[model samples]
Target: MQKKYQKISATSGIMTFDLELNSEISKVWDLIATTKGFAQWFPELSIGEPGVDGLILFDFGNGEYEEMTITVYEPQSILEYTWDKNMVRFELVGQDNKIKLRFTEEINEKTTHTPRDISGWHMCLEKIQGILEGKEVSFTEDEFLALFDEYQALMN
Candidate 1:
């Protein structure tokens, strides 16, 4: 899997990543669109409902939750939601017993936090891929920090 980061401007850009998984679309969909499944990789986020205008809860690990709105939804295929000032979308396509998961984030305003967010998402996608491949996955701060540095370099 390769990750693509595009800088549209000093304030806006896009990030895209793709994963080819030997799993059912439904399984991938659950991991991306449902609370329990998403928690396996990204524990801080969860979906509240199953359609557009639904809420995606962001748990701060301190009993506080931020409500993010779902902007698009399609069962076992597409899911898009508001992520802070950006937009995050996951698209799934199945072919020949494998599925391609495309993750895209539209960054409305790139700040100092952009690299951190991108690196976080990069690891989450890898975790998802590992789990789907029947492998146990764990992340360390050092690993994240190293990756974060790599993304931060892109910002420069």
Candidate 2:
């Protein structure tokens, strides 16, 4: 299925994407909230704790790490965190053996890297969906550049 994304705001700097997956809430929760599952779709995540106020460290595999503090954590429902000057949130809604996964990224400022981040998140969501569907996924640099161009057009 083709993923759909919405630009929540251009001035306020927010983007949202919703995904429909044929999976249970618990399984979908683990894919976003656990270190192992994150490694499969997102970045290599290391957490100091497992709940609200916990620290999540995202390792980009280039010896660089970004530290984010968990702002809200509700099991199988919501997970919010601080990322740099912005915030990232995940909300999972389940109905009859399927899940509606919502991802929102709140950007604080528009920088040159804004398009890159937006494109990256777009690809990451696709990866997450693929993993849930028992498929292998990888995002290539060319694909990212294409997405970056698309986001640039959207933003401008």
- Maximum-TM-score candidate: 1
Question: What is the lDDT, from 0 to 100, of the residue 136 in candidate 1?
Answer: 85
> 20-138, model 1: which lDDT tens digit per residue?
89998888888999998988998899877779999999999999999999999989889999999999999999865599999999999888998999999999999999989989877
Runs in model 2 with CA error above 4 Å?
Answer: 1-11, 60-64
**What TM-score would you give candidate 2 relative to the actual structure?**
0.88
lDDT of 2 by residue, 72-123 (tens): 9999999999977878899999887789998888877667787787788888
Best by lDDT: 1
TM-score of each: 0.96, 0.88
Model 2: per-residue Cα lDDT at residue 145:
88
Enumerate clash totals for all models, in the order shown: 0, 0
Record all residue pairs in model 2 with backbone atoms less than 3 Å apart, i.e. clashing: none
